[model samples]
Target: MKKAAFWIAALAVLGGLQLFVRDIVGAYNYQILVLVGINIILAVSLNLINGYTGQFSIGHAGFYAVGAYTCAGVVVYGQEAIRGATGFLPELGQNTVLLLVGLLCAAIAAGLAGLAVGIPSLRLRGDYLAIVTLGFGEIIRVLILNVEAVGGARGFSGIPQLSNFFWVYLGVVVTVVTVHNLVQSSYGRAFISIRDDEIAAEAMGVDTTRFKVLSFVVSSIFAGIAGGLFAHFTMYLHPNTFLFTTSFYLIIMIVVGGLGSIEGAITGAILVTVLLEVFREFGAFRLVNFAILLVLIMIYRPTGLLGSWTLVRAGRRPGRAA
Candidate 1:
């Protein structure tokens, strides 16, 4: 009951903030806020596998693309049928229902893709795993590039703008809270054990393979949801948008925020998003400056700004390890 109340309160706050942003925030800043929320989801989900499970996966973009395309296809093809079936619903209601359906489809499709990849590729570890995942991401992009049904190299367009600040931040809240709770559970202990030492964890009778695959599937589900939100918000999709560099960008977020920390992922997402915007002024030198900043952060902080710290409850001290 207490947990339920906390979530209710959080949702209430998110609703209030959404109204505020819709009413007062400037367009540019609003876009940034939504982007930050999406990045938070991506980073947090990836952290589940990379940080807590000690798995190296650079193919998150593949799952992300799967979700986006799946959601877009559902929304585009099913909207008319849904509208006809529920003509009595108001426009907002209809759109909400459609969005929910799309999100569900996206999650299922991405989860399946994750299972397929995790079962075979997860058997490999370290650099080999990274290489496999990276290749998977590129393979997804190239496959999408050749698929004319989704617009091929041209891009998928005409998508309805169904996502908003409320939905995006709600996703952020869900992702953060769910991951935090998961980390504190028995399954989380198993995941952490694997992260600490896979061989030791296996010796201790933990089914490392099962836990790793489960973590990967859960992580991919959230990434797919984030992709669905992005697709609806942007009202377009392109194969290039899910490039291997996009996966790297998410990696940078988790690293900057500190691995194995939910709060760290959120903090990293916000900081990286804002800093990228600020660096946009540098034009040709943007990547150079950003790279330098990251190097400096690593050289100085090493463990990142938060360094595995998590949000503590009231009456408890802060900076507690996750």
Candidate 2:
């Protein structure tokens, strides 16, 4: 079929590019690619609840951090001194079962945290909801700071670095495909209906509350998984990693990328991630640039760079550029 050929050609192009660019790109560029994957997952997942399902949730970082810390704890406790004895990859591969279990546990912990926050907070709307979610994020951060067992204020050290671009991009591909399918399916139709008009959606027999919770829980699970990958890849994680600043960056990504489009998510993630990394050497003023970029994007092209484009769609187009 055309779709199969499209995917094959796209893969060929990507393979060629990897061969050509592998020697030229720096380690930091690979890091950026990893970040791109993470941000894509984060932004798209948030979109499920906020954009597709029409809910306001600012506490996403809380679940993100929960997955991260939970994963780290398992790896640390399961391996114990092996963390100090060797590195993340060594300890990680030796106990593949434990690692997978750790990741799963991380997702469960985070999804539960999402339910904890969503149960009460999802009741509120508009500004009130934002405040509650924001509060939840702050509570998580402060709690992490006080938990001495996880290294608390000083941060956790010795996390393994087993994540690579393959895992990161694989996550990105999966997140996009998964959310895309969800949106285009029956449940996704309900989600879109809710977004269009909640009162009407419920009047039409859609269980708005149940669907909202479902979307929130699903988003949190994937976001948590991304966080787990992040923690392991970077090998160092702290409460500060999931602070308000992180939430802020993620918001920027969603805002800059069209909220409803997976392509927008990818475009925004790459743009913001690249901007932050490239300008990080600028010190405090780097953030100033970020703010300015946000302002300009909002003012000029608020729909996000790609708007509604999709890689699969692009692949489908006859003679489309690779």
Candidate 3:
């Protein structure tokens, strides 16, 4: 009953958001919303490995870039194989079907890459894993720089800009709900166990290795999905987008939101997104403001704004006396 109500409320909110999109949307304003949606998805996905599972993954951008390029390539060349150009989009564009196919394939390919990355690195924990993932992201950048088919350092373009408020927000919702459900399942418990103490979890027959790999794979898949949405929205893909700065921003979101809490993930993403947007206008002054906020958050609330435990009361009948 509660689940149904939750979905109903969610749908209503989305419907409401759509109605007001025009009132708040302009060329520049819409861009911010789309980016926020992407960031929200990316942050939530990264939280699976970094927060819920306890693995320190820095290769999120690698998966993201892969998805972007995959989508770009399919839109430019895959139309004939998937369907005719006219068959791609009857209402929106000349190749909407190709675009959708590209996004799906991009997500799948990135997920496979995540599996590959996890297989080798999940054995290591903490700093060691972080280093490997960091290196993996760099390697992806270098490889993209050399892939002549992807236009090398010049970057890939000609991608149809199909990403907008609807698609981006859809990704955000899907990622949030999927990760939420995953963390609530048995698998989630195992991931959390590993995060808290891998050795202890293993001793308890939790199969820490399996859980870590699963978490990493899940995180990468959603990261890829976000990448696809971004590429299509911007109509471009470049290696620079998946660099360390991007990873750092994601980590920041997790940190600000509160480690190990999904609510923290959303809160952090929204806060940072809006902050950065408003900061863009302050020129160099904005940097000072942003830095100060980070420092304060770290000093006073290292546990994060919504860290670890949420405020909850013991069971009591609803509408009854306290």
> Residue 190 CA error for candidate 1 (Å)?
0.4
Summed over model 1, clashes come to 0
Number of the top TM-score candidate: 1
Give each model's clash number: 0, 1, 3
lDDT of each: 0.88, 0.75, 0.80
Give the range where candidate 1 is weakest over 10 consecutive residues by summed lDDT. 313-322
Q: By summed lDDT, which 10 consecutive residues of candidate 2 come out lowest? A: 313-322
* Model 1 lDDT tens row, 163-281: 98989988988888788778777898889888888888899999988999999999999999999999999999999899988999999998888988888888888999999999999
* Residue pairs whose backbone atoms clash in candidate 3: 88-96, 88-97, 89-96
Candidate 1 displacement at residue 111 in angstroms? 0.5
TM match of model 3 to true structure = 0.89
- Candidate 3 achieves a global lDDT of 0.80
lDDT of 2 by residue, 197-305 (tens): 7788789999887788788888998888888888888988898889877876776777688766667776777888888888888898998988888888878975666
